[model samples]
Target: MPASATKSLRVAVLADSDTRWKWGALTAQRLAPAGAGIRLDGYLLRGRATPTARQLQEVGVHADSLREVTGVEFLRAMTEESYDILVLALVGGGVQAMLHGLRHAWGTEKRPVVVTGYVGVVYEKLADGLLLRHGADLVLANSAHDADRFRAVYEGVGAEASAVTEVALPFLGGAPYEGEHDPSAEQGRRPYTVVFAAQPSVPDNRKDRAYLLDRLIGHARRHPEREVLLKLRSKPGEHTTHIEELPYQKLVQGQDPPANFRLVYGHMGEVLDRTDLLVTVSSTAALEALHRRVPTAVLTDLGVRELLGNHHFTGSGCLASWDQLDAGHRPVADEEWVARQGVAADGSYVTAFDAARARITELLDRPGPLPPLTPYYTPETAPGYLPGILARHHLGPDGAPLPGAPAADKAPGAVRQIVRRAARGAYRHGVQRVAPVIRRMGEL
Candidate 1:
């Protein structure tokens, strides 16, 4: 099939350095209809990525390159262009910045459907940004637990959830696996090799690591032959900065690791490839393990005090609460919560890149009245550099947020390419781009 260039569904993703970016990008691409005319725009916010039409070939997103335009030009494009849907994501003041763009557009034309995912206030103070004040057409609940908390605490925090959703994340899911460890594969050894991995956070915030370490250490001291692995993705700073440092150095075939204690860093994929279990607290990596059929255990350190020092909750483990500590800091699959909490009732199953594309197509094709599914992560466009910020202040100052943002953040070049290329790609896949064309190009 020949490709078309009809950017009917226009979507803008707001992403910064948050991990949610990965989930959000995957969601946008996968949810768009096959032929439902869609155009995706990405704003990197603080990172190196920029969405431009040039990259729309297979990915279907456009990066804007403001390499040459002035700050005024950037603002003009933001206000001048109209979209069908806008997904607000980002940390800190990023949502505020993007809202500036949306407000600019609203000043000139009728507003489009706006959707935003809400992270709890406990995570950060960005919950009351401009987007919320202006009112999002749709509000997103990141998790089911979050929704329940919202309702219980603030009363109205999740009040709009009926019009909102707890979106499914990047793991769009695939055929089920019985788990990577085959009891038949190893004769005289243990039935499963469990592995836990994550980037370590601050010591006070790494209770999951401490808890799991304590339990695994105790188990290892007692058993000594369980083939258990504990891997922590290291940080750039000192060990003292992290919580209860990991144990037992490396895993050797003949080496005694307590009973089952083994700790390492970096290569989680290799570890998961050979394990029957993947354990974590709230780390998303568990999803990676789950995709391959590895059973995962989420444990936070509360009572596992025998093996490590300090107790707090951070890392990626799902063990955020104290009650979970004695229960081995484990969290259930959170399946029903995962599904019903986010943007879609079926949100908890995203995994594959291809599957997400199919979902995105469907989402874009469907008209409003029915809420659009919530996005899992924030989408980012390139930051031209601090120039735009300077321009906004009319300073052209030296304290730029980036090396090249001022220039790259201005032009419409990035979105133009997405419009053209995504249209073509959709056409080839037997999908047609739909256009509401509420108002044509010059109306602004």
Candidate 2:
């Protein structure tokens, strides 16, 4: 039975710097049918990969609205506050922190249900899939394919198979955002625009990005009537880690771009509307463009099996050799494939949401403590190990306290502001550089 109307369920979403806004908004809506009987709080994790205040602002979420919690604070929040569930929005990666934090926080006491959602369909080898499956109470999948993979991973490791739940990729849930730039509505008045959605730092994909951009630029130059746009992962000067990759900004700096060539930076949902044709190595944007009925192509020039396992689009019929696209062939979508992938804008995708809601309701009725950590990590020593890990990373409750020292009181005025900034910078640096090595050491 659902919690009584008099007592609302307290749900906290554990979001990283990059995902807080979307998850924050989605969790509030997804749980709305439960009405005023639920309160959703977005807590930004600030241990290793902390999201900068500026990054959160760009996501349109006010920094103040989110509760910034370190591992220590997170543990404290779980015990002190009456949260019923903690949605681990960092499922694919960074989930290890949440698992460790949970063990440290709850110790022998019951912990809130830990749920996680999938980000996409592409299978990047999850080193800790079993660990995550063991730790997470329920892992919401994006599709049947994802659910199967998730299930196989856990079942392969002799963990519980019932933990996987098929949920539509959160973005696909609810109503689609109707953007202003509809290609069909504009028709002859607007130039035919080809947009290439950029991918992250996959070395093989990054190496050929410049070549791809040049192809599009060359095509635009030859056909001056058409326009070509490179939709960047982030605009230059944005506090994004796209710098980890070869940024397109640097790639296009000295090149002579034609008048028809432009760089676009916006939500892919909006950009796809203006886009008559979309090209990408293997981006989730391909899924979006296909759903929008926009012509889309998955580039396989470098080598399909070698570069990216974009075989997820195999049925889409939009895969093209770079030479084919260079010859001005507009790739066509395979309706059969679209339906199979559930990217079709029809009501069919909603079934995933139905299953998700059903699973969530079931969990709400039977909430209890998390399982022993020994099943996933160093259960026997997690509590002891966690404090030292937190201290090493300067992730003490009040702010990175010096090792073995108590947290200092917040300094007054300018001193406080300066101190916080320096600490945050150090946190980001440690997460980017030191955390990985330390984590690997722990595994060893």
Candidate 3:
């Protein structure tokens, strides 16, 4: 435990989507020193992917206080209240905007230690995303491999690299998989279950998504005795961390699935409890399955491409095709490879966040006012790029709220709240229904 174990801490998390909320909330709990009382306040950033009530409930993490707020609104709240730490669980643009906004808002006043990082595999937008998140006090890396990559990116760009800290995925905790041979025998034994975790936008096109769906159905038909589950991240019309231009639910509509096959929704951890074989095309659920010692596979049916993110598992020894899986192929994970990925299947999971906790504690114990939040991209450094990012959050070049920006201190009336919900519903309708139709029309 760190020296700050005796101190109580107030932490605030600002997240945009369900996955990020899960990551940020769990991370806050893990970062707190053992035996320290923590007051967690959650701020859900309002946007296209902003989680619905159902999504929030599925995440199953409760904070002392939780509310929805716009980016500028959040900045105002920070000025009115105080917290020991702030976890920015947002996209690169959002993090960058908040860093600048908070810099101007706090202005010489003591500020919280800001932290941010990816929710899962850092397989896309390596430089763009990392640089946007550059100014954070700690840019958390979920693995030693990620820590090295993060440092290299920062040092290569001549930016400060001290902020990159190694930590494991905070959400990777569940009962380890027991042996396949059930000692309890047939009377109490459950059927072998195969779960295919679906991502929102990995195989973005209809053809690739349809092909994967067909394969899942075929697998179900072949293995009649096994329970085949399509574990969906969100329901139709609901958005997650990523946009789903082509949802599996929609693609599976015309097919006649076998009785043994089903679409399951809820927590991934709960689904993993019954999973004998976990399959995916680079969903982060693969990491969760690996951490629990479950037999896992990253499909090569669509090719090992960066777009699919399966390229990240090149040496994991868990990459295999569905055809091989149907022939009873179970890929054995390489232990050294697993360790490097921070899966912690060997009971090393308990100490994964020690460094993060120690660092937070040390920062809290600092004597006087900490220096201003200095981001890598200033007006002089990224004149063209930085302005657009801040404008999206209603912030100006100097981080002050723009003239037309909504006043944060003003509370919306009953009619305004109703209008806001209706607008969001209309926006989702456009994404899930209208946009696909337009795309199909263009192809025609």
Candidate 4:
């Protein structure tokens, strides 16, 4: 039997009509296996979804088609359902639409949304996503980078969010990420090798990855003795399915210069262990490589600017881009660094899992009816009733707007260019959004 209901503490997982929405929902459901008595609802807003209310089939499992609701209407439902928790999945444009939809779904009846997404350079996205999170009771992040970004956005919006996780290694029953593989399988095999994880989502985004892989193949070809074991990660949904129908090991050897790249599709724990030098575009597998003491490097792209920011050591040279893929570019990560990644045999993701559990529990226990988050976002000085509107409410004191922790910058326009590029990327990848503001001087 299901757990007792706690006055309909519904968790509405919004699936904004993007494949990303499906991906995010699957991810969250996998991560948060313990909803306890809290009800879980999955609402997908396809073009013709019906907005009819049906009995939640399973106590915490609800699947519905949100008929014809814009992002705003969807958000407003928080007030309608009195949702205790609103979990926003990372479907690029879904957020802006949802916020616009919920223009009036406030008062004590609304639910808090734990909005999450990648926090790269999407300034407005980071801004808007944070604003909603600020409005919602909590925000969960997939990575530390995201957590910190949300923190800034929330603080900017006059709210605070509990840090979720830097890397979301999931647990089934509140269990640690023991990673479904055994050491005996790895201990009896391969002398030295390297595995790389590749996830190609957006078409253009994968170009850089293809280029890097090509370069690696070239480097490997030039040196035959230094066996470079390449493990390709290409599972649909789990990662990007760029090579959708490409048969596993089908891309292995004799295709062309870069054509002979290795491939593995079903799953990837043992492959990760066998890897010597983990390489990729921007997949989080490098961290796994690090934990495994496998030296790592990005194919050198602006996307990887976050991790490959600087040199690890003067002569160590653990990080590099395609431009620096010299046959001599091999860098070694010591046992200590790999241990942190859970690589040196004793390393497991258990600690991080425990920490994540604690965080979720704390968020669940926090008092509801959080202060309104309007005053911190908008600035004072040249606004009419706005300042008064923000202050008259129970909102907290104003602090500096959490100007999104810029990716990297010491000057002007650089961050803007990056953030704006990201915003454009979000739009380009089929993300629906409220129309951009038109700034011009035209005839009336």
Candidate 5:
């Protein structure tokens, strides 16, 4: 087949870190062969506060294709460039920020289809509802439960219900044997292996990190034949801080973990490959583990409904506590609950690659009416904010501003990079340290 004969599908995936990258990669892979002439190219749109494209290199995300353009540049590209679709691989304020820019650049006549939706398991819908009601042409619902909720909510809110696409968990289903445990593998050699999927940012984990670590350590100590692994969200020196996630390493720093337990990082697939049992408070990783037929237990040690956010798993018959684990209680998988949640018998998601392909093809074949611009960003705000965005990026309708002087052309590049890094580091340090003191001082 001649390359030129194929129809090209150019996609811009705006991502800040690994969470969105996972979805972007999945979407790109699935849409790669939607039609006979379909040719797909996925580009990473990165900016300030985002994990650098280099950090995602290990996951086969190439740095070469990453565009470190500002919000203004993104708007200009969407308005002027030729692209089939643009996916905002983000949620909450991060998404609102881009929608603000898009409001200014969007035109009623010609533009690429804009898409975004909830990227995580929906514990609550209030915050997600606001974003989904924003101007996405296609809003992907991660599960049947979510899809139904999206339709009802959007319809009630006077937004288009047709925009919602019911899809399986994008992280699962497409990849075969992705998280299957392999006892014969070198890393899986332990008699029984357990992986604690940590979500450091979750309030329950942050408040009870020590208790959680102690519980895991005790489990390892009691079952000397078993090895327990703390599967960290990020590695020791890597930057996967998508939304300011606290790495679990900081929690276990001064204490000694048992010999049977250790910390590991990399792809979830590699980590889950050796996992016989999976434990977490309310991590979405439970879905991944369950999909692999690896028994999963949702820890209810710290107020299951109030603090842990594992309330959804309660009816699923996957709930356990540190006390329960200590008493040798392991949760049995409940098929009835699983069916209600729309999870398949083999644990594969209902939304397979074929379904994903069909959905993408359908959206591409029929680009819908342009979404309203001022849903999230008011017309008044765009006027004031758009210029600031342009000035920050040194961009204009013409292009990047011309050099003022010969010295300006030289531009101390390394110094700028160093200063930017220092500023970000200081800001993060302040949030971690000063914020607590300020709050305490206010209370006093």
Candidate 6:
């Protein structure tokens, strides 16, 4: 197959949340050959972290068709429809379950090239997550450092390491930052803006979150001339890729915020347009900011523990504290570290996906039926662990749909649909409203 060949490719992305959906959709476009037509379809996995309509809108990606589906329902769709590619934008267990189900469903038959990878930094579950995703046709590593780590993990376990392909983060393109505070700019200077990118569950506790919020408010008070924005992932009662038990939105209810401080929610890239300094504990938005040449900080205020995920940025030279930031200290990123982490600050991002594109083209151009999907963990290899993961998705060890799995595939009637919506709303209400009250009562 020629690199310039034009083919209309049908790509289906099964995403569990908004962040993953954005990553998957953009990656589908990036993986396709240049000038090729793409018909993208989306399947949102129904779960606690399933994205709300507003969350999907905030993602700002367009799919030709989009709908929510259960694990079994998605498996059925794969069996019935034909697609050139299937991107599993899911967790490790979800990806593993789908691999087994698809293997059984398409036995000896031609199937789409299945792809899966992490949405951002792989801070935890290094071995467990990689093994669960081992059967994927291409397990994309978003940086050179990750690719090396992935291959090392695979070979350490005596598994094939060829499927790990190096690629840059797909959602990393925006206008380069032009030194927003440059005094000699032709246009009038904009306000010096500091954006704190908030994650859902990094701090994961009320005390740490409130402390960070206070620091942000203090920063606003100290620099009244500057604009401080708390860039939140999702609103109250809405879930993103991770669950937010103690959202900053709720924490700021009674506190008095300075006029310069405010909470803003929109596309991260758009917010970065006027941002002078971007800060986070461990959010992937820091990478986005760095890619666009914006000064980024990964805070070490709480600690550099793995729980905070700030340890992943240890070598990036972007680690700093709120005290340092308040002192007008901007840490320069290490060029060598940035290159290894695949930030693409040097404009190498244009060709980052070339290898992935070529690999997909070769797979699509292959003659005859392709080989069966063989995952690293089999019934023999992981008798105790693999079955539980499959059972959660309504599949047996052999990937056959277990009894009553078809019930999940059935479309709900109008009344049942309404009831389902109400149930989800109640669940969110419990998480946001009731749970906090109960916790406080317990403390008292």
Q: Which predicted model would earn the best TM-score?
A: 3
- Candidate 1 residues 1-444, lDDT tens each? 212123556766655433334444555554454554566666544232232322223233233321223323334455567665666555423443444444433444455556555332223233343223223554444455454544343334433333334444444344443544455655644445656554434223224445545566555555444566666543221121122232223213344446456566543445665666566544545555544445555554444332321121223233343333323433334444334433232323443223334333344445544332221112222145323533442223232223343444424577865774566345323311122122233356
Global Cα lDDT for candidate 6:
0.91
lDDT of 3 by residue, 338-397 (tens): 999988999999999999988888888788777899899999999999999999999999
| Model 1, position 105: C-alpha lDDT score | 32
Off by over 4 Å in 5: 1-6, 36-49, 62-64, 125-133, 173-188, 204-207, 235-246, 340-356, 367-412, 437-444
Residue range with the least summed lDDT across 10 consecutive positions in model 2: 236-245
Our model 3 lands, by Cα RMSD against the true structure, at 1.5
**What value of lDDT does candidate 1 attain over all alpha carbons?**
0.42
Q: What are the per-residue Cα lDDT tens digits for candidate 4 across 1-444?
A: 222112334556775433334434444444342545444666655332111122111112324433333343454456557554555553333443343234334534323545444422222345644553333333445444455666776566445454435444331122123232343585554333444555433113234435545666666666443345455443222223122222223334344643234455433445555555666554555544554445677554444343332222222235565556454565555445444332322444444334443454555555764433332233453254233332322121232112331222222367864774465445433321122112112212
Please write out the lDDT profile of model 5 over residues 1-444, one tens digit for every residue.
Answer: 322225666667776566677676565544443444333334444443455444565455432245544444566566666666677776455455566556555645555666676556677655455443466666776667777877777677565566677665666542433443455898635466888898746653344777888788888888877888888776533444333334567677887777888988677777777777789888878877666666789987776774456887878778988778766666767877765554554644544445545655555565465444444334343456444543444433222332341112232489876876677667766655566568668979
Candidate 6 deviant stretches above 4 angstroms: 1-4, 182-189, 406-411, 433-444
Put down candidate 6 lDDT per residue, 1-444, tens digits, no spaces. Answer: 463348789999999989999999999988888778889999999887889889899999999999889888888899889999899999999999999999999999998888899999999999999999998889999999999999999999999999999999999989998876865578876679999999999898788999999999999999998999999999887888888889898899999999999999999999999899999999999889899989999999999999989999998899999999999998778889889998899999999998888888888878877799999999999999999999999999999889988445466789987887888888988887788789989999
Off by over 4 Å in 1: 1-10, 37-39, 47-77, 80-83, 110-112, 118-134, 143-163, 172-180, 186-191, 199-275, 285-294, 303-444
Question: How high is the CA lDDT of each candidate model?
Answer: 0.42, 0.61, 0.93, 0.42, 0.62, 0.91
What TM-score fits each model?
A: 0.51, 0.78, 0.97, 0.52, 0.80, 0.96
The alpha-carbon lDDT assigned to residue 389 of candidate 3 equals 96
Q: How does model 2 fare in lDDT? A: 0.61
Lowest summed lDDT across 10 adjacent residues in model 3 is found at 179-188
Whichever of 2 and 5 has more lDDT, that candidate is 5
Question: Which residue pairs collide, candidate 3?
Answer: none
Using lDDT as the measure, the top candidate is: 3
